[model samples]
Target: MNTITDTSIESITIEAADPDATREFLAAAFGLGGRIRVRRSEAPTTGFRGFTVSLIVAQPSTVHSLVGTALAAGAVEIKPVAKSMWGVGGTVQAPDGTVWKVATSAKKDTGPATREVEKVVILLGAEDVGASKRFYLDRGFTVDKSFGSYVEFETPGSPIGLGLYRRRALAKDAGVDESGSGSHRVVISGPAGTDPDGFAWEPNPSEQ
Candidate 1:
């Protein structure tokens, strides 16, 4: 059995065909902080095939603002802003092929939710949901919710929620090609500082 430790995603590294452009888009759209690292890659990227980076906001207004910002930054809208079972949300694809979902929970609805951003979720599209679920479970992530082909896990003291979804299905939902190839442009970290399931880890230089 693998011992679990307090873990959190340190950063998500995106290998973009045009790193500077990708970085500018992200900054303009989401005001991406130091947590996101963008690097140039000559190697072809399959684009956002099997993953979504979600921004959880405190209110519906923020969701609208984020969606608009993404569009202004050259993102293609996959889903327009609308009310869903969870709350009001929308989806967009970044120029670098990264899919982003901006949403807020209905529970926070109180005569107009505030515009404060809450959390970020990195949802990974796994070739095998069960295998990916187990990989994180063994590494000490506690399951928050689980259903067929979908699972959500939360790390201790980490605001980010990691999720696993069926790859082809996720790609279909994002309105993107189901082809899974090239660098995934993602990174996860934890207190253990150990790589599981062949995931790479780069310690935060500032934290060191």
Candidate 2:
């Protein structure tokens, strides 16, 4: 197995019908740095192809506030803020139709655990979970957990966690339509450059 040397998710690129609007919405909601890249697509995209970008905050209190901020910034509520066994979380759809899940752990912790924006998790819905998992595993992502329909990978030294899920199930969880085609509308970057699963990283001058 090839061990991936660099695990950090340097940035995410998105293809959108209105790149500027999507970029503005994301910036306003998450206060993203230059890490997010957006490009305008000549045609409309369809399908449950896009990935879910999760922001894990240190404080549970920040969850609701962040959800509200996203709503005010033109994100439609997909799942309302609620506490579950896992933690507090809510789902929303950005103006460009990207799904986002904002959450934090339910259990209280000490010290730095109370900080905001604990980590960013990228969950890609795959047409074939097993194949996708194998693709990532071959590229050096350690298996964190796995089940029949889902598998998560640990990106060491990275504030990002990557996962693969069944496309239809993911769409259902996000309260969105499972029928979409065209562009996946997502990009992931790391030191490895690209993966067998078809995610690629483009050179960013800002990061150089």
Query: Which predicted model would earn the best lDDT?
Result: 2
lDDT agreement with native, every candidate:
0.73, 0.75
**Per-residue alpha-carbon lDDT of candidate 2 for residues 1-208, written as tens digits (9 for 90 to 100):** 3234455666777778888898889777887666567888765577566478888887666777778889999999989988778878899988887889988886454444322577788888888888877776666678988988988887777556788888888888787888877667776666445444455554433456
- Global lDDT for candidate 2? 0.75
Candidate 2 residue-wise lDDT at 192? 41
Expressed as tens digits, the lDDT of each residue in 1-208 for candidate 1 is 3343555766667777889999999888988686677877766556555678889887788888888988998999998988878788888989888899888876345566344567878778777788777777776678889888888886556545678778787777666778766666654544434333334455443455
Index of the highest-TM-score prediction: 2
Count of residue pairs whose backbone atoms collide, per candidate: 0, 4
